[model samples]
Target: MKVLLKWLQDFVDIEDNPAQIAEKLTMVGLETEEVIYTKELFKNVVVGKILKIENHPSSDKLKICEVSVGTDTVKIVCGAPNVEENRYVVVALPGAELQGNKIEKVNIRGVESCGMLCSEKDLGLAVHSEGIILLENSYTLGKPIYEEVYKDLDDVLFVINITPNRGDCLSHLGIARELSAVFGKSLKKIISKGPKLIGQTKEFKVIIEDPNLCRRYTGKLVKNVVIKPSPDYIKVRLSLCGMRPINNIVDITNYVMLGYGQPLHAFDYDLITNNTIIVRKAKKNERMVTLDGKERVLDEKDLVIADTDRIIALAGVMGGANSEVNANTKNILIESAFFDPVSVRKTAKKLGLSSEASYRFERGVDIENTPIACEIAGNMMQNFADGQAVCGVLDTYPLPYEERIIKFRPSKCEGYLGTKLPAEEMEKRLENLKFGITKKRFEWDI
Candidate 1:
């Protein structure tokens, strides 16, 4: 799991640096594999504007561009088809290194190219791209690319090695919670209410066929959503966390999942046959094509999310291509749910389909976070996609989570740890973790 330092700051105010935080997390069983300082990799890379574009005299495929990087102007040879005059682009100046390749004053086809025009792939921000990254007019010229993406050029990324049992720590909030506990700090609370509903709409229905397979399912509708590129901050954070940005709708779901550790899915509302969602077991030999364009066959033991006519998603694994959100998508239905760990694991293994959602589902997610995550995604859609959320949430929760209380003795706990811990300190730690405590004469109820 890749955790951004700035993202963690949303939940806790820690005064430790990256190395110190890594050590502290390591002491608490969350091992940090690597710490990436983005500033070092983006050294000397700045925003530049294209002043002139001229076809290379010696080569037809290459064009010579006069780019203004703030105060200085330099000539660069580029071959990307999307290059245009007056557009802001990423420029790697002399002495800059990209993926270990150095940019320098070199002649390309007899033309002196003083710097290099960079694509997202060249800067290691994306795995593939056809053209150089085109920045919006909001970016300042000659500013470091890192400064535009992150508040501080020194934004750090922690590549954490999460064990199977620690699935709860897969997100920024989860990590922040651990940091708060380890450092004896309070975890900050965030408000996640969606836009005020215009009153309940009878547009959709949700059903749960079995309580054992699916514990809870929550959904919200956002109408008239504009499908467009996400804001710079959302795109940058997703990229920094190793996810490719698709669109505002999809990115918002992924963003909420990353921030809260609860995976969400969006279905194009027009594609839902009956405006209904049914969480139930699949029939034997039923097949559906997923977003990846591969057909998967399932049996009765497999769980799925279906509409009246057909399956829309392989439950907890992946959404179907039939209900996929696209450039023309206007109405979106967001799904946030919890499935049985064993059921999700079996279906994912049999179909050889594992996703970020499946990964979290198979291990388990906070059952109570389903609705909260849905609200967060809905609010993001409202703010970013020009969407208006419908008032009520369609929720089917047959099996509600029951709180567990474990009784313990302070002396026994101290004996297990082989330390001298007072009961008052023990109660303080448990309170910091948000556990209900009831003190008794001889023992404590937690």
Candidate 2:
């Protein structure tokens, strides 16, 4: 699992650098396989503002821009189509080195270009179709762009080589809980309460026809959403966490998935045929085009999210394009529940559609976190998409699983560590991690 240091800081305040934290975490059991430092890659890039832009006297397709690097202004020849005046752009000055390349005063056509303007692609920051990044007004000119861009940007991705038995550690919260235990700190989380429905959710019928394959299926409807691109902060956070922002609706689902480790799906309410959602085995001749626009044929072993008319999503894998949220979608049905991991895994492998959501779901997310994740996504949807709260939640389950209980003796812990730990210290560590303990036994019944 890749645990970003910024995300880790949200849960615990550790007074150590990423490398030191990685080493400490390694000593405890969550082995750190690699530590990536992005700051080192961007050494001398600075924010620059385009003061003026004029057509290159020599080349029609080129533009000569006077850019301000805070201390001084310099002329640069740029060939990009989107260079404009009064925009903040990244500038690599002459003699500056970055990513093993040195920027030098060079002649382009007949002009002596002293520096080069950068695009997201050029800086290896993001993949955008635009010419150059029109940085937000917040960036101070001449400041080291990397520091401004990557501040609070210590991401120590712990490639935790977890054993198969530790399926619980597959999630961020689960990992945080474990670390809290290891470091004797507290783990806290903010869970949302699902949107208040204006009407009963039973009006929109839901059925789990294949209970064996779909262990649980919980859904909630939200209305009056304005589907637009997420805010800049939301987009950046998603990118920092290694996900591309699609739209507000899709981004909310992905954001909640990353924060809480539970996969979620949002379907356009109007596109769902007959206001029905059914969980069932796929038919032999069933075919679906997923959101990525790939046509996939289904097998009998595959579990699907279908309506009376057609399959809307590949269960626990991906949503179909036909029922996906679009710019015009106003009402949506958010799905957050558990699918049989074995079945999801088998179907994903068979269909060759293994997304991050599917990968985590197939491995097994914390069942207890389903509602919390759903709540977080719902709240984000309302806030980011201008979505309205609906009254009721549609929750269907075959059985309720109880919390896990494990016992650890104080003496046993000390013996295993081969270090002396007082009973008070051991209890404090376990309690900090949310483990409830009696004087005689240690138990976590949440």
For model 1, which pairs clash? none
CA displacement after TM-score superposition, residue 294 of candidate 1 (Å):
0.8
In candidate 2, stretches whose alpha carbon ends up further than 4 angstroms from where it belongs are: 57-59, 79-82, 92-127, 135-139, 146-163, 192-203, 407-421, 439-446
lDDT of 2 by residue, 341-434 (tens): 9998898887777898788877787766676666667777888888885655666766666766676677777789899988888767768777
lDDT of 2: 0.76
User: How many angstroms is residue 45 displaced in model 2 relative to the true structure, after the best TM-score fit?
Assistant: 3.0
Local error of candidate 2 at residue 440 (angstroms): 4.3
lDDT of each candidate versus the true structure: 0.87, 0.76
**What are the models' TM-scores?**
0.91, 0.86
- Span of ten consecutive residues with least summed lDDT in model 2: 191-200
The per-candidate count of clashes, in order, stands at 0, 5
